[model samples]
Target: MTAETHGDRQLAVRLGELLGPRHPVAAAAVVTPEGTHVASRGTDADADADFDFEIGSVSKAVTGLLYADALTRGEITTDTRLGELLPLGDAPVARVTLRALSTHRSGLPRLPKSAQPWRRTITLWRNGTNPYGETLAQLLLQTRDVPLGTPRSRYSNLGYELLGHALARAATTTYSELVQQRIATPLELDCFYVPVTADELRPTALHGRSRRGRPRQPWTGEGLGPAGGIRASITSMARFTAAILDGSAPGTAALDPVAPVGGGARIGAAWITVQVKGRPITWHNGGTGGFRSWLGLDRNTGTGAVLLSATAASVDRQGFALLAEHSLSTGNSDSNSNSNSNSNSNSNSNRR
Candidate 1:
């Protein structure tokens, strides 16, 4: 084999070894600022590792991006309230702002009580539950125990569902369509979408599991699509990561107008920040019935990669941490531009 081919195989094999082979489903795409792509194991040899995976919460980051795009276009503002955009029943969600929902400070529940827990029994693509509309209906009927602008962070899926719906309303379009027009299409992400049917999912899509260690069928998150329910390939995600790292992806949308979440350095829109060794590792992971995936980018180095797998393996922590360490070391830079932007955003809120 040629040296380049051998080197690629070795990288994939070493990644597999370090993270373990149990990661039944795996796809990775690494990209440099110069626009070079390194496709590793588990990717379809025919494609550019552009295959799609069921990116769980990573979808929220997409939603955040879409919202930012809307703001840039003057479709909405960060202070827009949930109740004003969407017709919430008796719930005071109207007081909840776009910033609150995006940053996880909205005091919304992690998941709505009405969500059917049948994900374990049904196929992931076919899991049935109330659609986004019905989920919002239920939210209107419920009562929130906390006041608006609560400092605590509970990580609510229902909250994002609301944000997605609000964004759709603000854009005067469907949620899926808004995501497509605002982020996916502009970014030239050919393999990403919120598929309505299982057949629409790629064969390489990873599956998620339950706490008992069994595969789950397709499940509907009720009003949580904004928080998750996104599927894309490693190639698409690599571009997505690159856009986030350098704003050089096919799209030119801003990452935020909603601002950095919490006093903690772990979340942006939907992405999470993890400090590996001493460098900041900005990333996010998603697990759904029949699918689990992770994406990470080293902001300091402008380098990133996407890992898509069809298995419920627990190798995410290892694979992401390992790649993060290597990438950070390779592309270390002193730029604090992203951090400074976030810090300025949090200057107004005293809550931790």
Candidate 2:
């Protein structure tokens, strides 16, 4: 008889504690600028490091990266109005700037008005529904002259959906195609924007479970792809996070905070910045049906991490703990020394 490997036992132990018997196979990964570590708490020979899971709202930050890269390429500025890119017509939302949408200051609601009582009840129960079936044409038709709240950092899926579409419009490509061309290609990530009629996903897509441990429907619908349709393996996310922290990612500019959202949280294009033990940490979390994911970076310490789970359990707390490792004094010392080394190198080169 073959004995279980230490990693497998550890995963079993951790999942046993975190899930308390409700566990559906889960995985977590930590990706620092210099290294990466991954652990699996459940077993599935088919679901190795390459198995992709829906990242939910974490797609917003990915969209933010696309926005920042667009700005870098001089395609559009943050001040660009939504109407300038999309065919919003004379809708009041046409006046909202891409900046406002990226920072969630456009005053758009968390979701469209169409998602109704069923959405509320199902979400509360984690029943999993494809709440985003409205196509781009439908989305534009739904826009009205409804007044919005004052500009501030309020989470808005609708705003991001529009923002992604606008960015794609500016690039003359579909949202998924833009992501693949700009972000995934540069970083060599295996992630993809999964559409609702995704026939290719049947073999790899993991079934999501409701909070009550019942299996739920898969999250699909191409219309909502911009807001929350991307999926990737834990390792792929880790690699992406590592790239962002090191400034190699095209969307690196998205990590810079653009506006404060009170209580010490600042909003970037779509990423949120918070302080942990006095070091700035940029992060975003996502959840859909039975999946949840997180991406975080600490530019000051040149380190970052990602947490991806196949269950709907929020990974925010685990993300915070792992990401905070960079805030420790040791990590800062290494960063300071590296900064000094780089400064000296630059000075010597200048002398020559």
Q: Residue 195: error of model 1 in Å?
A: 1.2
Residue-level lDDT tens digits of model 2 in 13-37: 5434444444456666665555666
lDDT for every model? Answer: 0.58, 0.67
Model 2 residue runs over 4 Å out of place are: 1-23, 47-49, 117-127, 200-202, 326-352
Candidates' TM-scores? Answer: 0.75, 0.84
User: Which predicted model would earn the best lDDT?
Assistant: 2
Model 1, clash count?
20
RMSD values, in order shown:
7.1, 9.3
